[model samples]
Target: MTIELYTWGTPNGKKASIMLEECGLDYSVHPIDITKDEQFGAEFLAVAPNNKIPGIRDTDTGLTLMESGAILLYLADKAGKLMPTDGEERWRATEWLMWQMGGFGPMLGQAHHFHRFNKGKADYAEERFLKETQRLYGVLDKRLEGREAIAGSYSVADVATWPWAARFEWHGVDLDQFPNVKRWYLAIAERPAVQRGYSVPSAQDIPMP
Candidate 1:
């Protein structure tokens, strides 16, 4: 089945593409240029009412989905790969994925906005987000202290979280400071599927810490 992947070149967008690549799924990429307000177009709105990047239509199942977290889980189940099958490992994977969704991604996005894009516009916002960004990184570092992957193996949690961490520079994060996280990030970065997915809809080098 050919999946229709509607997305832009953003962290969230890369999540779906990365999962697709990892699953060895056949898919077509339809670039939605959010910078040009293309996401608001009626066609995309039909697929993603939230007007966000990284929505997909699975021709095999005729299932349309939005939200990066949900998409990762769906693809994992469909592929029967990149996720734990049962018990605590599955829930652990889900937990870390939600951690990325709830805290890491949003906080890092704010860090990008206040610290990178709109620097000097708001000192308080910059400091606040940056502090939170570092805190979240510490949490990740601790979680990764003795693990190769977030949950256990190379699962959807890694797929969901790695793209955001790829933008560590934008968040002004020095991966060197979070040693465990740096190690985990670098290892995941070396994956062939991750390298392929990171460039979906366009080609861009993955940033090194």
Candidate 2:
């Protein structure tokens, strides 16, 4: 059986879609336009009580999973390719995923909120998020200094964090200051699958603004 993926075009939603494509999994993408409040509807909220995109249902396992981190783990387990099976390697993968959830996710999310989504003078919010984001970027840069792909392998950890780091330019975070991170982000961003995942939606759905 196939998986049903309910998601939109945002970063969190794209995480699952990219994983699906990378794993060569058979799935359906349901575009939920958050601007029109589709994610808050009854049906969507049922699968995702928090009414968020990136929730998926596995027909084979009869499991409904939400959150990008959780979905990545589920798909990794299903694919048996990008995830480690035992020992410290497995824990390391899990640690990086948690880093995304706890560090990158929150910091970048707040940056987006204040920079793009703010309607008023939310200077404090913007500054706070940007500072936190920079700190997190430093941590990532240090981690990637002598390594490749977060955990020495191109696993879900890199996949999970790449989008967040990629958004730094959009959020006014200087990439030049962090050479290692810039290299890592650009390398992942240049991949064919990453390019394909970013182009999932049709031209008509794209906003002129």
Candidate 3:
């Protein structure tokens, strides 16, 4: 059986699709066009109460799930691939993944909204988001100072946060300060799986920028 992923091109949505691709899971992508408010429609709302993208229905198990983090964890558990088997390593990866879900995703999402999508340039909004975005980048940078991936492995935790790091410039957050993140970002972004995963929701281009 195959998994069906309803997703958009946003960071959170990309996280799940990237994981599915990296795991070599057979799946289909149903692009939920946020611009057209497809997520708010009845069909999507049935799959996800929050009417959000990045949801899945597992035909093999008859389990339907929402929220990117939950979906990532579920997929990881199902595949037993990206997550660590050891208690300590698994906990470490989970903690960082939660950090990305709670801290990084929200802050950077707001930064993108205020900095790029909002009407007019709001200095206060920019300052607020940039400060938090920079702080979050610093946190990740320190965590990755000498590491190759988050939790010392290229797991779901790393995939979950990769898109945000790649899109830092859009949030007015500089990459030079987070050299370690930059290194990891370059490595992951260049991966064949990541390339394919990141391309699913893109109807035209695969975000070369």
Candidate 4:
């Protein structure tokens, strides 16, 4: 069951690689260099119509998938791990995963664009995204209080969120301000699979907050 993981070093891309490592699945990496606009090439588009960095083709099932969140769910189902089988726990895990897909990742991306990469070019965009980023962090911190993982027990929720939180510095986030999130982020950082996955297709140190 070798999965061909099409990805880069971004957070969303890391999610697929990290889950692959966690599932102990045999896989190969195909680096889609978004930096050089290779994702837009027709060949890559055949796998991921959205032209996204992280996509996958499961050789055993002949399934090609796009979108990091969808890929996570599919891999969990295929491996029968990370995701809960039933009950409130399952829904709770799904909720947090959705939260990451909707708010955490997208907002932080905008914050990174405005606050970090293009600072002063659009002050209003910067301020709006940065403020939203802080609010989202506060929400996550509160959810993490007295909890080890985002959805109780390490699951897809944690896998989805941790990579985004790993980029705290890029979005002007001070993990110190969100102690619970900081603790959660650090705890996940220590996982051997996470350490391996964070450097998928290339080697890069996980940024310490």
Best by lDDT: 4
Question: Candidate 2: worst 10 consecutive residues by lDDT?
Answer: 200-209
TM-scores of the models, in the order given: 0.98, 0.91, 0.94, 0.98
Residue clash pairs of candidate 2: none
Q: Candidates' lDDT values, in order?
A: 0.92, 0.79, 0.85, 0.94
Better of 1 and 2 by TM-score: 1
Query: lDDT tens digits, residues 1-209, model 3?
Result: 47989999888888888899888899988889999999998878877889877889999987899999899888988988899987888999999999998999998888888888883579898888878988998899899988999898888889889977768668765576678877888888788888888877783233333
Write the residue-wise lDDT of candidate 4 on 25-97 in tens digits: 9999989999899999987898999998799999998889999999999999999999999999999999999
For model 2, residues 1-209, the per-residue Cα lDDT tens digits are 48888888777876787788778888877778898999899878877888888788898988888888989999998988788888887888889989998988877898888877882578888888878888898899999998878887888898888866656765677788888987888787767767666555322121111
Tens-digit lDDT track of model 1 for 1-209? 57899998899999999999999988999999999999999999888899998899989978899999999998888888989999999999999999999998988998988889999999999999999999999999999999999998888899989999999888888899999999999998999999999999999999997
Off by over 4 Å in 2: 202-209
Ranking by TM-score: 4, 1, 3, 2
For model 3, what is the C-alpha lDDT against the true structure?
Answer: 0.85
User: Cα-based RMSD of the predictions, in order?
Assistant: 0.8, 3.1, 1.8, 0.8
In TM-score terms, candidate 1 sits at 0.98
Q: Show how many residue pairs clash in every candidate, following the order shown.
A: 0, 0, 0, 0
How high is the lDDT of residue 90 in model 1? 92
Model 4 root mean square deviation, Cα atoms: 0.8
Candidate 4, overall lDDT? 0.94
The C-alpha local distance difference test score for the whole of candidate 1 amounts to 0.92
